[model samples]
Target: MVRRANPAIQALKEETYIMSAVFDHGEFDHHEQIVFANDHQTGLKAIIGVHNSFLGPAAGGVRMAPYARMEDALTDVLRLSRGMSYKNALAGLPLGGGKTVLIGNPRTDKTPALMAALGRAIERLNGRYLAAEDVGMTLADMEQIATETSHVFGRDPKAGFGGEPSPMTALGVALSIRTCVRRVLGRDDLKGVRIGVQGAGAVGADLARQLGEAGAEVLVADVDPARAQAAASAAGGQVVGVGDILFADVDVLAPCALGAVLNDETIPALRTKIVCGAANNQLAEPRHGLALAQRGILYGPDYVVNAGGIINVAYEVSGTYDAAKVVEHVQRIPRTLEQIFEEAADEGLTPDVIADRMAQRLIGRS
Candidate 1:
């Protein structure tokens, strides 16, 4: 008797072949799927990149930005999606990595119709990807997306448990920074320790507040002067100029902004003992991790430190959202960082490299 080939298996083979060809160009990173979506009526343009699904459905946030070019939007989505994969794996969440980028200014261009269109696009993926809140999006914006689909996380608060993730993200980064201080500075407390926080957005502001509450001296900076002043006021911190934040003479540098800030030029100027924050893809490239290491900087791999937000959303996805459980899970972040640091020491490798290898092995990439 002859048997028929499973359609899913055949589809996987075809996808593998196509991806192999795309990989040769050095842009593709073994992503399982990429979808370009447009809606003429709503003037919505978006790209969704699903990096992997070995653990479960791809889960990530949808960020809206007024990217100057389509290519820039694509690059951000690809890098963010890949980062989500490593983040989830390290956090031990039963979810894969994916991300969506909406190419428009969220403040001026966002509309209910546009969000609905984006939701429909997510529905078309048939649960392969889940959308949550990210930069340029809010809980209310997520509600707009939820109007069209059920495959969404980081929704409105349920029984006052799960909602926006930035606060939790800040908590995780603060804890990880404390861990770094302990490891590199031989201090268990943050008392009087100076911390320079770049990007006074949601996560950065909250992180500055947390650091201040922990007895650390927080210096805040942002592209927007108002935001920087507000964050500094809230945290009782000093507002540093954006240009000088990177070179602030501090014990720690927390880059809570966009990616690629730790490039060739910034690494030499980083005047801190540790590099750790809520930013995704903080290292401009893999080599930048080694460069940080070479400079005697203890880098707390960004993905590992920023998993609290994802952990919170994962609980929302599991159908039973428990605030306590989510916090407990986030608390494990420092332990993971400690393990990564120990392994890096033993292997004589950068923490980021060690973390990437560990996450890759978890996701069947290695």
Candidate 2:
């Protein structure tokens, strides 16, 4: 079962990967719904992946990424939406999973008109899916989207909405790292702990500051020098070369940037005792989880540890956006990771596999 992308959308998605115009619906056939949005007037072409809604309304973020093909975008939204389902369920949120993607270069293509068109497309879905800020999308963009539809989250704090979830996401990852460190090395605090953070964007910058506050020596690496410098300034950290983040001899390697950064090429070079972060799909493949374990690295699955953002916005979806409650909930992320660590040790499975099983049990019942 496959649907080829229309010509208009195909042309819109070719800004990232250099490829032909071929497109398909991708491999994840268990999706609850898939919406292809194209508004010629606004030049908005996006795809929303609603992976599951049995637990509650599907909630996730909208990312504007340059993709080579429509199929690449679909594949991403589907996987990420499904990951959100698992992420929310494990975090004890009363929400399911969904996500979106606007195909274009965020640098020069973003506009209020495009954002509103995406919002209208989301409005068509009613409450089946909720939107927040994701990669390449900003809170200001969410505001423009809100002008067209009320089903938006992550607006500016001045507007009295949930605001950006990246800080919360970074906080969650820090807590998860503490959990991993405590259980693995019997440490009580992060003081003097060496942490290498890849990607110093919104979430990474916050995570770096959190690490500094916790007394950890932070090394930040980003492809963008300006972003790397800002992160270092934010956390009083040192900026490492981009190639060093994956191989540096740090106690914990936190990936705060893009997904699939940890692959066969880099896994063998990791010297960290703990692998955790705010990036989704850190493992290039499922087998990479076991690889981390085989090398004696305590692996904290991406979805499990980086769920603070979703937990923050989940409240907004339910109309009870409370800051304190969100923080309290995020604090429980470490306990959740502790349980997974214990279970994985007993069952000889990686934390990623354990987490997936836990989410599947709930998904199956739902």
Candidate 3:
């Protein structure tokens, strides 16, 4: 007698083949759900990835960029959502990881109607995921999203109960930098330390200002010349060219902009002893963490150090947003980094590797 293939197994195999054909599996970490949203009337094309929901509802900011292809957008959402899970788990937040990527040039393609349509898409998730502000998004955009879905956070302040999280994120990065300085440079302060900040956005500029006020000589750069100048002025620092900031002879290189900046070509050119900033998905690949370690550069894992924004937003969900409480919570970042560093040293591994293990265990994936 001849046996036949199980019908369920055959169907799953076919589905897997179709997904592989459509998605770049390299970045498609075991996500729980992936939603492709299209609205012809508003021209809204978006992808939402939920990596985990074991802790609670998935939460992450909404990012809009002019991605050349939908495949690139899908890869971005997958990696970002996975990062969100690690970030929230390590931060001890009762939220899962997820992200939404809007495919368009925010400056040109975004409209109130488009934002409302995106909100409706989020509403259809029925609280499975929560959205907030991210790159190319602002409090106004989040407010517009909230108009359609009650699942949005990171809006403007309401009697200091809730507000934009960029500043809080900057504060956490600054603290983590200080922690790195203490561990590597054996210093209790940042006086006279030369720190290069790449990207002059809200968090970068604020971080530069804090670093400058702490007496570190700051070098800042942005793709936008005016924004770079503004960040420099605000920090009382100097502005470098975008290409030069990464290779600047500084004590630390803070990538506060986009992801995948620490990949192959850029790692060898780094002159800094430490890399810590507010950017998500900074490691182009997991191996880059080891590369940084091989170069004697102390790297504060991006998700671990840049978790302040999510922590701030989580408070609003609890209806217990307190300024002092938020600061106290953000301050925990350094302790977490210190733990990762200590364990990495003990195990002869990079901090990112240790961090990933710890986060995995926390999320019960281990």
Candidate 4:
């Protein structure tokens, strides 16, 4: 099937009633492709956004969410895919960025057939886009999709494939938080440094535990009470309510949950001296990063700070996979982040904008 590009599509952007109109608004200009996939038999309705592939074929994740509306899913994928492009650029990976989002209640609608349908949709992209597990997706789900197409990542380790990247991602985030502390807090140790974590999922839990073990005062909260309790227990920290996590007065605030948590309202409420997290798109918009900078808060660029997961997968994208090499690559994230911080300070630009410049330079796009 071929898509007809129409000049009139630009006018439709003003009509927010339609979701596809979002593409013509400016997203189409930033992205290389936006594909809507549907399979009636499997009931798979998904979208894949390939932001840029200047370095190589786009690589990101396949996410499934019970979004309230198709517009929500579209907004998420568009933002996430663009974030991946920056993530790759900052991580020094030779790959580009892309992401797939499946809209449905994962609890009931995600069947093996749906995974296969999503995989088939990816196959249609030929090798231009690769998929991995993200947010609501799992490694097992990626394996199921792998049955339909070879364009996937995060397979089981038993098959000599890369498994979940949460561990290394946690390591990278911890190191980044430390860098923030040293730069802004004027400290080299996290011991006795108060920290608040907003999310207790895989990466967040691991980050909390690591921080706790390092003698930091860690506080955590999650929408799921059980998860929050577990993470707090593992980290030897206290559990707070979801609403209180943002306003908690701490040296560093780590947001590990959803994107756009740093919008206008929350930025004003932030009491932390440094904002560093494992979440992507932490800023609701680019301006929010500048807002944080203007407030004298050190804001670690989300993509630059959280490149461990992508770095772990980038190893598999090239020649033979090496665990040691992947660990080395992920560990090097602190240096990359340090460079971003130094450059941002010297250039007097927000880390977000500076990191974007860094990425574009590497891919010859700057």
lDDT of the candidates, in the order given: 0.92, 0.88, 0.93, 0.86
Give the clashing residue pairs of candidate 1, or none.
none
Top-TM-score structure, candidate number: 3
Candidate 1 lDDT by residue in tens digits, 1-366: 999999999999977874554455345688899888899999999999999999999999999999998778878888899999999999999999999999999889999999999999999999999988999999989988989999988988853437989988999999999899999999999999999999999999999999988889999999999999989988888999999999999999999988899999999988999999998889998899999998999999999999999999999999889989999999999999999999999999999999999999999999
Per-prediction TM-score: 0.93, 0.91, 0.94, 0.93
Candidate 1, residue 258: how far the Cα is off, in Å: 0.5
Q: Which candidate gets the maximum lDDT versus the true structure?
A: 3
Q: Write the residue-wise lDDT of candidate 4 on 1-366 in tens digits.
A: 898767577657634444446655544447888888989999899989998999889999888888898778888888888888888887888889899999988678879999999999999999899887788888889899999998888778787777897787888899999999999878889999999999998899999999999999999999999999999999889999999999999999999998899999999989999999988789887799889988888888888777888887777667467889888888888898888888888988888888888887776677
Q: Over 4 Å off in model 2, which ranges?
A: 1-29
Sort every candidate by TM-score, greatest first: 3, 1, 4, 2
Winner on lDDT between 1 and 4 is 1
Candidate 4 local distance difference test against the native: 0.86
Better of 3 and 4 by TM-score: 3
Q: What is the C-alpha lDDT profile of model 2 across 169-270, one tens digit per residue?
A: 988999998888888778989999999999988999999999988899999999999999888877878999998889999999999888888789998888
Q: Give me candidate 4's TM-score against the actual structure.
A: 0.93
What is residue 181's positional error in candidate 4, in angstroms? 0.7
Clashes by residue pair, model 3: none
**Candidate 3 structure, TM-score to reference:** 0.94
103, model 4: CA deviation in Å? 0.6
> What count of clashes does model 2 give?
0
lDDT of 3 by residue, 1-366 (tens): 899999999999977874884455788767899988989999999998899998999999999999998778988999999999999999989999999999999899989999999999999999999998899998999988888999999977863436889998999999999999999999999999999999999999999999999999999999999999998988889999999999999999999999999999999989999999999989999999999999999999999999999999999988888878988999999999999999999999999999999989988899
